[model samples]
Target chain A: MNFLSRLFGKKNIMTDITIIGTGNMARGLAARAIAGGNSVQILAHGDKAKADALAAEFTGQVSTGVLGDAVTGSIVIPAVYFDAAKEIVARYGDGLDGKVYVDITNPVDFSTFEGLSVPAGSSAAEELQKATGAKVVKAFNTTFAATLGEGQVAGQKLDVLVAGDDEAAVAAVAAFASAAGLTPIVVGPLRRARQLEQTGFLNILLSANEQLPQFQWNSALSFVPAA
Target chain B: MNFLSRLFGKKNIMTDITIIGTGNMARGLAARAIAGGNSVQILAHGDKAKADALAAEFTGQVSTGVLGDAVTGSIVIPAVYFDAAKEIVARYGDGLDGKVYVDITNPVDFSTFEGLSVPAGSSAAEELQKATGAKVVKAFNTTFAATLGEGQVAGQKLDVLVAGDDEAAVAAVAAFASAAGLTPIVVGPLRRARQLEQTGFLNILLSANEQLPQFQWNSALSFVPAA
Candidate 1:
């Protein structure tokens, strides 16, 4: 079921992005990557069928492989949960070095639904950066997977809040977002991911809130820039 | 120099809102309250002239007084910093009991510019609520004072995120926000203020960022609702 674009023994076609996991986020981000004229490689969680199914839906625009197979994209995104994201980094290890690793996970502590699961003053992106030399950039964490398909909420473009210490990495993510027809708002260093996660958490809370019927999972925390 | 609304012996006309401090926030919020058809009272910090000057700008639409004077509004907003907000609550004591006290402070730890100045689990609103019997509602903290004047960002209505344990207090703040030509997004109980504070802090960081010139102080962290 693992359909290799090039022969396993031959040089594979490099992709603009490698998305780990075959979930909604994976599908959503892959859509954006394709729309942005960027090729994608899907590294599914051992479910070759699921990966193949999604790849077929994308009209064979993406290369499909299992998680352990070599990641063939310059930009790697684990469209998985925070814990799983950490595991992916550990699995890839030094292989991710010099690659743009985008951390879109919001580590929410659902135990109390009180705060984030990450430790104080640090963010998921920063922690993921610690696991490898990957240029970790925090983007799309503030954006819901549902909204990424349309690339907007309401009539406004989705504000992709990017945070990373690596300038090249941040710019790379921003370029992709802009190419996808989304507005990328660079929110300073990786530490700012702490705030971005909170912003995302607040959005989730509002969406899940029965009291706030207006705010849904598809809502966008759009930063309306001054004219 | 305390320009009492009425003499110490006479009955004063109660206002719909009382705002402490004559800073930018005070002026901005006063604009909203008046636009909403709500009368305001300004309680300045021993600066009767400053209070009088602002009250004059409102063209006698608001009453003026120095701090320690009796609060006359059903809803009182301390349009001051986090530290000064606590001081105002302490100065008022049980007099604020049964009133709607709105906490609009972010409490950022400027020394590190890292996380919030508040403790790990608590927020400015929750802390302020504990200090007084006043029903503390968190609103306008996520909004910059500059936007209140025009009441919109990029032609969209300003989103007022309100949070509080007291449904009545929360409702009251929402009502005010709605009347002021803004969208009042109730983001759950006062506990959610923790995230709201983080949201506000993030907005501040984005604004102060010299690199992201688009995200200025006049910009907005708008939660664009799903259609």
Candidate 2:
């Protein structure tokens, strides 16, 4: 056992999370990961300066690298758009084997925001899973970037709707969510990602809607338990 | 405008709603409409006895009739499945020109439960709107029949998400929802029904999942305001 583990009596282990992309989602996730006491790595696509800037905001063991470099974490989160997320997985290839891949892409067709870009009966997470052998978990797609930045909407903690075919992988993600001060609701298998993506699209549509003034980008999707 | 209106004043004006089908959803909606002080008519397709039985359960101004009979209400709610809802709309034709149509169909392929049965970029509400020139509003699809029976789940009022292209039609449905003691969240136009149906399908998928013990059929989807 390591000295830290022996001294603490409990396993003093820190989860290592690699976040791909340096966008708003990437920064939100990195903030949560750092707050959860996990080590985070920022990977920038073509722009190393962006990753470095994001990493500089954190004090913990945060690292920066360019895409295609060797991923150093067991749980890799792709916070990029749908197409980029797929490309990242394809480019990583066998490197993601056995690793828990967190997919936060909404897969919405921005051109119209009317429908999903994914093919019928498939989701971005499922597509990522098909591209690589990683344990892909669909999460954070339903949450807005602004909500994730604050980790809560209004006074309620954000509900992270997670879906994955692998139970252990889902539990790992759930643990990460709980540690990050978010509520994790594991809806179902990876196939449920299709629904999650749809709901996420709906949430985004509501946020963009001018009619619903109260539903800003800071709004969230939550499943309230019956009283 | 009429003798009834003169007798009861503005407060005495109760909306007359014609609900097609005598199924669980039909009964549940009828119960709510009655409790909300609205006159409800039950329309049965090829089965008058079922509609009669449902109408008999309510002491309020509830009536029963055949499907093709003249719908005697400003708001006509099709509580049947997607296919049947379409058929009803097609049969009604121009008779539904100015009336408000409430579409409660989910249009989910229950056999697979993987996706919606509606065509790409279309929804059951949208298809129904195309069939007739009636003002179509999408609501009550997300609320389960049992939950609708009580009009609230776990002490929290059920959120009836209303989506329609007609502002007046949406307002009428919203008024009905408020009278029924439920919160009405008008998402957007009829096109937004696409997302509502997707979220309904997702809710069903979660309810059917044996792995998610907490996601019982009684669970309600709510957008809790941040404190």
What fraction of correct interface contacts does each candidate retain?
Answer: 0.94, 0.58
lDDT (Cα, tens digit) per residue for candidate 1, span A59-109: 435778898888888999999999998898898888888999999998988
Task: Put down candidate 2 lDDT per residue, B82-197, tens digits, no spaces.
Answer: 99988887888898899999999899887877788988878888988888889999999899888888888777788888999999999999999999999898988899898899
Q: Give lDDT tens digits, candidate 1, residues B1-227.
A: 13554455212567799999999899989999999999888989998899888888775458888899988899999999999989989988998999999999999988988778888878999899889999999999978888998888888889999999998889999999999999998888899998999999999988888987887789887877787
- Clashing pairs for model 2 are A154-B226, A154-B227, A155-B226, A155-B227, A227-B154
lDDT measured at residue A139 in model 1 versus the true structure, 0 to 100: 94
Docking quality (DockQ) of candidate 1: 0.82
Candidate 2's DockQ? 0.55
lDDT per residue (tens digit) for residues A66-130 in model 2: 89877877899988998998889889899889999999998888887778998887888888888
DockQ of all candidates, in order?
0.82, 0.55
Alpha-carbon runs more than 4 Å astray in model 2? A1-15, A46-49, B1-15, B45-49, B56-59
Specify the highest-lDDT model's number.
1
TM-score, chain B, model 1, is 0.94
Top of the candidates by DockQ = 1
lDDT of prediction 2: 0.85
